[model samples]
Target: MRIPLIAGNWKMNGSLALIEDFGNAFSRTSFLSNAIDIAVIPPFLYLANADEAFEGTPVQIGAQTLYGEASGAFTGAVSASMLKEFGVHYVLVGHSERRTLFKEDDAAILAQARAAIDEGIVPILCVGETLEERDENRFDDVVLGQLDAVMKGLSEEQRRQLVVAYEPVWAIGTGRTATPEQAQEVHASLRARLRHYDENLADNMRLLYGGSMKPANAQELLSQADIDGGLIGGASLKPDDFIAICHAAG
Candidate 1:
């Protein structure tokens, strides 16, 4: 069985104060232990601070994004190597905002994931269909296409190292969530496709539900067989709520 991983994606948000606050949460609570894996994706500036703050705990520090190449003259771009230097263990690849606002394509996103994977960092690949695509009845096709674009290029070991987050574009941060059944349907399909690669790896792989997952709906969603955990957004900015969601995973 896959061990649940409840990660907080701070997006473009973080602060020294928040790191300190998180440190307190980890130290004071036994719930943040080995029962489940925990991680916080802070902004670029606070990566070191977050890593340092959570150094002695089970909670890991992750990056929201990264440049695919190891080194380049690409100004303002952070490479996976730089992230590794700061102790980043996981990264969010192809987040909706990066795909929509920044126009990052599937190939580029997978390159970033490959860079991180090459550096021994785990990549939580974000794959989902938009509202329009789902409305047009292309949900499964679109999601699998995005997933295939990345998976086909990876080795079996690299594929196993990946974590998938199925964030239906329609539900993300709109104060709406896919019902447990709705979310499970997508997760199940994703896993079924994964099974074609290697049944054992697919069964052990974690497929997270990333769209608008919060404390109120966490329990029911987590109970789904294929929905391993969450790639939390808005709720992640709130320590109590994020932790509550993690606790619910248990």
Candidate 2:
């Protein structure tokens, strides 16, 4: 069975003090079982501080974005190797914010994923459909299309070392959420597609729900046969809420 993973995407949010506070609160949390894994995706600037704060804890540190190339004149770009030096074990690739705001296409996202994999980091590949695509009945086409773009390039071995998050663009940060059934359908579809590549790989890959998951809906969502955990946004900003979701999962 795949271990459930609950990851928080700070997404241009939080500061050193916030990290400190979160670290303290998380350290105080005693109910989170070993049955699930947890991660915090903070902005690159706070990675070191986060690593320091969460050191010796089970919670993993992750980055919100990263560059494909290892080293270059790319002044502000961070490389996977650099992230590894800071004890980062996971990174977010193809997140909706990166896809929509920064115009990171599938190819570019794949490059980042490969970079993370090369550095022994787990790139939590974010794949989902936009409001337009969902309303127009192209959810599967758009989502699967994005998945296929990268799946072909990754070998079976590489495929086995990955995680996926399905964040419906329409539901993210809009106070709206995909119903349990709605989210399950896309998650199952993703697993089915991966199964075609390699069943064992597909089963090993943890699928996370990223469309505004919170304590309120975490249990129902986690209860889904295909749904494993969450890629939390707003709720993750608070340690209480984040751990509550983890509690729901545990």
lDDT per residue (tens digit) for residues 140-196 in model 2: 688988888778889877887889899899885566668999999999999999988
TM for every model, in the order presented, reads 0.96, 0.96
Each model's total of backbone clashes: 0, 0
Off by over 4 Å in 1: 173-176
Query: lDDT by residue for model 1 over 1-250, one digit each (tens)?
Result: 6889999998877778988998888767666355799989999999888888887778898999999888969999999989999999999998888998999998899899899999999999898887778779997678998888889989998998899998889776466557899999999999999887888978899999987888999999999989999999899988789888988997
TM-score of 2: 0.96
Candidate 1 TM-score, true structure as reference: 0.96
User: What are the root-mean-square deviations of the candidates from the true structure over C-alphas?
Assistant: 1.3, 1.3
Error of 2 at 38 (Å): 0.6
- The lDDT for every candidate, in the order shown, is 0.88, 0.89
